[model samples]
Each structure stands twice: as structure tokens, then as C-alpha cells.
Target: MPVKIRLQRHGKKGKPFYWIVAADVRAKRDGRYLEKLGVYNPNTNPATIELNLDGAVDWLQNGAQPTDTARAILSYKGAMYKNHLIGGIRKGALTQEQADEKFNAWVAQKEGQVQGKVQSLAEAQAAAEAKAFEAEKAVNEARIAANAPVVEDAVEDAGETPASEEE
Candidate 1:
């Protein structure tokens, strides 16, 4: 049986969550799988992916063909890159320790980038909230100012009417 690495649909409609799996090509999309590798959630900002790096690389090396989207996901999570490094190791261009060190450095860099994006998104949301508050404050001040003169005029009229009656 030819094996393929593919995504299995899971979550509710319009909010797709997927399971990355290694399965026989003839198996149903969400049906029997050789191994459950990980998950992908696209609803969240930056799209969330939890993958087993080693498992995915093992499948790739064993000739599991990935679908287009699955390939992108695997590439993003570094399985494809790790497989390449392992290939280099096989050809004597890189040692196992060196390949592992390179993979670790890449993972650390990817994590830093993701964290940076999250931080920027949070800062932008805070700025928008602050701008909205300031606009509301300005509107309230204008309303109070517009009403103040009417209140003063009403008080003066009341004072004049009573004094004129007494006179």
C-alpha cells in the first residue's frame, strides 16, 4: 500500500481544524491512519500547528508523499528541512550532531519570529482601543459644553422673573 501524509478534517464548519496523519492512499480522508502526527488550527491568529518533527521526518524519508497543503504545513514545521539535513548526513556532507544543532537553531529562530508577531498584534489592538476611548471622551466634552450655556441662561431668567415680581 502506498502511504501518504495528509490532513484529516475535524473541527466545525467554517472553522477548520486538521489532523496530520500518515495513511494508505486508499483510506478515507478521516478514516484509518497509520499514525496520527499532529494538528493544525487555522482559526487562530498566525494559524496554529502542533507537529511531531521526528515522526514527520521519518514518514517523509520512508516515501510518504504529501499533498500540496500538507507539504506546506510540513515545510513550515521544519520536517522537510530536517529530512534535507538527514540526507546531507547520509551523503557525508554533514555530521548528525551538526545537523541537530542546525535544526535547533532554526527552530529557535522560528519561535522568536512567531512571538514577535503576537506581540505586535497585541500592541496594535491596545492602540486602537486607546484611540476609541479618546474619541468618546472628546464627544462627551463637546456635549457638556453645548449644554452649559442653556443651563446658565435658564438660571438667569429664573432670577430676573422673581425679582421683577417682587418690585
Candidate 2:
């Protein structure tokens, strides 16, 4: 059987959630699978992915070909890099310990980048909310100011007598 790694759509319309799986090539897009590897959620700001690194690498080593989108997902989650390191180890180009060290360092760097993006997104959202609030306050103040003179005129008219005063 030709095993393939692919995504299975699972969420509602307009908002998609996916399961990453290893399956037979003849299977339908969302049909039966050999194993569920992980999940991909693109709804979040950073496009959240929860993957089993070991499982994915095992599949890759066992000759599971990934679809393009699944390939990108695997690459994003470091599975492809881990597989590469394993290949290097198998070829004696690098020791297991060295491959582990490199993979760990790469994961740490990727995490830092993701964290930075999340923090920047939060800061931008906060700034936008503050700006909107300030604009709304300015508009309300203008409306009150525009109505103040009319109110004053009404008060003056109420306090003064009619202009028909006697001789």
C-alpha cells in the first residue's frame, strides 16, 4: 500500500480545522486513516499546530509521502527537520547526540519567533482599541459642546420677560 500523509477537514464552513493523518493513497480526503498524527488549526493568529514529532518522523521514515499542504505543516512543526536529522544520523554524517542538539536549538529558535509574533499581535490589538476609544470620546465631547449653546439659549429665554414691557 502506498501510504500518504494528508490533512482531513473537520471544522464548520468558513472556519476550517484539520487532522493530519497517515493513510492509504486510495483513501478519500477525509476518509479512513492508518493513524491520526496531529491537528492543524488555522483559525488562530499564529495558525496553531499540535503534532507528534516522533509519530510524524516515523511515518516519514516508513515512506509515507506528504501532500503539499501537509508537507508545509510538517515543515512548520519541525517534523521535516527532525526527519532530515535522522537521515543524517542514518548516513553516519552526524551522531545521534549532535542531531538532537541541532533539532533542539532549531525548535527553541522557532518558538521564540512564534512568541514574538504573538506578542506583537497583542500589542497591535491593544493600540487599536485605545485609538478607537479616544476617537469615540472626542466625538461625544463634540456632541456635548455643540448642544451647550442651545441649552444656554433656552435657559436665557426662560429667565427673561417678554419684550412687550409697558411705558
lDDT of 2: 0.95
Q: For model 1, what is the error of residue 97's alpha carbon versus the real structure, in angstroms, after optimal superposition?
A: 1.3
TM-score of each: 0.90, 0.94
* Model 2: colliding residue pairs: none
Give lDDT tens digits, candidate 1, residues 68-105. Answer: 99999998989999999999999999999999999999
lDDT by residue (13-60, candidate 2, tens digit) is 999999999999999999999999999999999898999989999999
Whole-model lDDT per candidate? 0.95, 0.95
lDDT, candidate 1, residue 5?
A: 96
Candidate 2 residue-wise lDDT at 138: 100
